[model samples]
Target: MAFTFQINNELQFNHDEELLKKAEECCPEIKKETKKALHLVKLIQDQTQLDGIGTSILEKDIDQLSDYHLKRDDSLILDFGNHYVGSFSVDLDQVGSPMDAPLYIRLKFAEMPCELNAESQDYDGWLSRSWIQEEFIHIDELPYTLKLPRRYSFRYVEIKVIDTSPKWQVVIKNPTLITETSADYSRLEPLSLEDKTLQKIYDVGLKTLADCMQDVFEDGPKRDRRLWLGDLRLQALANYSTFDQCELVKRCLYLFAGMTAENNKISANVFVKPKPLPDDTFLYEYSLFFISTLYDYNKAHPDLAFVKELYPIAKKQMDVTLKMFTEEGKFIPDEDYPVFVDWSNAFNKDTAGHAETIYVLKQFISLSHLVEDEDEHIYTKALNQLSNYAKEHLFNKEKHLFVTGENEYNIASQVWMVLAHVMDDETNKKIMNNTIEQLFPIKNIATPYMYHHIVEALFEAHLDKEAIALMKKYWGKMIELGADTFWEAFDPDRVSYSPYGSPIVNSYCHAWSCTPVYLIKKYILNSK
Candidate 1:
């Protein structure tokens, strides 16, 4: 499922006060820091940069920001030197004559220069234009500080003079952004890597994770500012590797556990604003990821008491998902509860869905052992059945890759099969090598989320060189394209592709794309 638009408002939910209280107790205190614009910049056409848009320095010091009086149709771009998620404020005053007409200005917050170059009026994407991060304001007084009330995620702030009186111009100064996040950078231990590129990748990943860590692990601080199950799974893994903030993970777990559907199924994501409420959207693999997340957390932190508290809820998720399988152990994907192996639905997901069942079932069984559940054998039997079915029906002997519905062989099926360990290590390596030979220079798939799985599967298969190569090729390309932080979607073949049809709405710093830290630490640095 692409996750474009989904609404299931008819579903009933249970808000358990006990779990909600635990969630509140674990809520993190957001850290705040003030950052000033580093330089004045203007957008210029450059085919090398993202969307063929690059920035040029204005050669003016940030201290002299107030000297440049802006009249009608004038504009200035403030470069913060790096990406950040926060609120912005600036001091403004009149320059010449008395304030006659109201100063109508438009402020645009952009994560990249291309976003500043793109016009919101030209945006015809299906996503809500309200998420454009551009605000229009009219100031009637002079020497007043215009502090925006909403939080934004960006690295560039473009102030455009929509209209100003011919008698007077506007003077702007002391533009400040209050950066916000719940991540404690002081706790980050310095890691020295001989490989500079890997170090850079790790650092970027850490920043991406830190920015997304607010009261909860948001998918993106910009758009979809909420906790998603699939994104949470990857974010928690990266959190364990880098920040290791177990309390935030615990808080997120309780939020999910507190508000499941009436049928005990977990929602795809949850909203934290008005209150802790689960979204109506649901994904089969995402719901199963709840089990995988709990398993990974218990492994990282070893909280037996906490595991016991959430084990039953996790088990219920497993039970409901397991019901989607047939007696032959083949997963029948429900359109109502889709399997989100990747955003592209062009490929069949049956093989990926079956492999995902095997993946989460293995983790669930490990949790069952922690709680010493009596029904462990039932899960074990299901795992065996699913694995056996995959090995027998999905694996193509000649192609040396997994096949999905109607013998459709794609990268996702192969990647998920390797990750699930549907076959032995030697065979898994062969499958991955075959996938590279057949599916090299991947096409149509544009998400870092899917790319993360492919890279991790390479590591799991002991194809370290291949794994590092793919990471550098995919993530390094983002850095080359001038990304201070990673993006939600990027297709090397097509740099301008957006699931939302326009880059204006795409999340530049998504949580799922922050897995390089986890990968480098676990695979390259070999850190615990």
Candidate 2:
């Protein structure tokens, strides 16, 4: 329940059977499709492609995949044409002389070609090497099906022979990925748009969301398959606008509510496999976002019964987070429970965190009214205090921007404050204009999640052209760099930046980056 759970296993959660049962009942049946390898390709250095790695489609036909024979040290790469979350398998047979030695091979699954450039053994990042999506196997017999049990999120699978024997070679054929997803692409209603770029951005964004959808709305199927609260908030918004899969959103909400700590503090994320369990990770804004997620869900697909069912758990998040703020309405960043404004801690987050609190408190108060919580005034007062503090203390009138630690004015501070609507309409526009003039050509900050906030803030300030331009610049650049789907982090200035010290660990199709669909639907399509 507290930070003590880090060292001691004193953490215990209340598993409401009814809520957990509803979560189980709402688990969407995972749909699967058998996809054959589309083309054979070789990875080569190309400056134009992502991470300076591009694929040259081999002349060989995928229909005759077995025709190619590989000797020891030979490797083959199969391009599946599109991104998918699934398990991979291929028929492996021996060629020439009798099977002498065991067939030792390494299979590396990559979401991007650049990831193939990163050697798993060379990956020295802080993230677990287990998440590299590489597997080493030894086959004692010939004519092996070689069906890997582990599911992988990838479009390229590289098979490298370590040693098959000097006498014989290996024949690879029938490479197939049993794709998994709970999202129904057929359910997407077709729409007409004039701007091709925005249309493409929305399409790619939808694909990104679909790829990440599973038993739960996973942040990244390739990596942290856990259901993160922060990702859930954004994914729910996008889902409402796109697939409209309310059951999945409700399942996710109930899961978070069902697995809360004894103190009713929701875990930042939850592990869904081997039975559902919550992780010890807790973020300040993430926990508070539970209320926001529920509020958005209700607005998109209203169900008072559902709102009432989860109201107490949602209310607890606001109640718990309000304690993090001081009597003076200043948010104190706790080392044990830090605010995750972005993955990068490169900037001061107190003001952004304070603004974020105002953002969630407003949502909490709205939900409080829906369920008729009599103590709604408590949340309203807290929201007023947080907003008043930001307007009075955090703003820099001279710069027309919000300042954080050491008098630093960052993009996040302004974006979240605008999203919170802490300032009036005219002031919000000035803040965004100043943010664009002073903070143009954004650098160091990477994460489509933050980019989504900035773009939405721009749109909210009635800067549609600026919003569209920024979206095209940031998200469109990912498309130019050969993103079949949007990436988790991309600072255009440093195209090769990775939080995990290697591009191999970066999520190319993350859920947080899928908000362009929501943004487009809300701002552009629904524009006056």
Candidate 3:
């Protein structure tokens, strides 16, 4: 399914207060750091940047921020010189005359320069406009320190004087951002990668993960500031590789375990504010990922007691998902519980879903071994049945690729199948080779999540050179495009592509895009 807004308000959820208390207990005390504006800037046209917009440094120094008071329709951009997620505060006063009327000011926080150039009114996307990081405020008194209540993810802050009485101008001073995250920098292990580009990618990925680390691992701190199961799976992997924050992973697992649908299926995402409520939307792969996440966690930390406590919840998710399988071991997709193989619905996901089932089942079986569950044989049987079905029906030996609904050959199918390892290693390598020849420059796949899978599949298939080339090409392009952190949606063929229809609402530092840290650590550095 496409990455768009999904609302299912009618679905019922049970919130276990006791488990929620555990979630709260595991919540990390967010670390904060104060940052000051680095320079005064103005938007200029540059075709290289997003939206054909760039910034030019103004002649004024940041020290003179309060010298030039802003009148009606006056504005200036403050460059923080880096990306940050935090609350913004600035001191304001009146100049040239006594305070006459309330100083009407508008502030726009942007992670990039293009957002400042795009007017919010011009946005007509289906995503909520409330996510636009612009605020209109009126200060009735002089010498007011305006601190925004809502948290924002941005690098550039645009200050516009919507209206300040004709007699006086508003003086701005000490514009600061109090950045927040749950990451402890000191705990991070240093890396010494010889490849400069790979090192850059790894560092950016770590920052993206660290920024998304909050009360819960948020999918994107910009708009959908909530815990998504798919994002949680990837974030947990990156966390284990870098910060090694096991408690945060435990907290997230308990949060999802504490609340689930009446049918025992975990929600695709959860909300921590106003109360811990599970979203009505459910994705088959995301629910199954709970099993993989727990598996990865225990493999990393090996806590049998924790796994035993949460094993039943993970097993319930597997049972609920397994019921969707047909008698022939094919995954029958349900409209209520869709499988998210990728953002594009252009390709039928049955084959990919089938492969994901196998992937998670393998992990779940490992978890069963940890808990010493007696029913491990049941999962093994299902896994074999699914693998046999894939090889007999889905695999096209002649084409060296797997086929999905309507006998279509797509990259997602091959990548997922290779990841599932339904075929032998040499055959998997040949399938990926064919996939590279057919789908080298991937098109219409806009998510880094899917790209991560593609790269991982390449690594799994022993196509190390091809994997590194794709990584440098796809992620290096983001670096060339001036990304401080990776974006939520990026298509190398289409520089300005947005799944949300407007780049204004796209998250620049998304959680899923941070998998390079995990990939490099697990496959590259650790392999050595």
Which segments of model 3 are wrong by more than 4 Å?
1-10
Candidate 2 residue lDDT tens string, 1-528: 111224326887788889989999999989999999999999889999888999999887887778888987899999999889999989999989999899999999999999999887788987788899899999999899999999999999999999987899999988999999999877889866799998889989999999989999999999989899999999999998988999999999999999998877898899988898888878888898888899899999889999999999988877888988888798878887878877777788889889988988888888888888999999898888888888889998899999999989899999999999999999999999999999876765788988999999999999999999999999999998889889888888889988889998999989999999999999998895
> What's each prediction's TM-score?
0.98, 0.97, 0.98
Error of 3 at 317 (Å): 1.2
Instruction: Give every collision pair in model 3.
Output: none
User: Model 1 over residues 42-103: C-alpha lDDT tens digits?
Assistant: 99998888999999989888888988999999999999999999999999988898889999
Q: Report the lDDT of model 3 for residue 376.
A: 92
Ranking by TM-score: 1, 3, 2
Model 2 vs truth, CA RMSD: 2.2
Candidate 2 segments whose C-alpha is farther than 4 A from its true place: 1-8
Kindly report which residue pairs in candidate 2 clash with one another: none
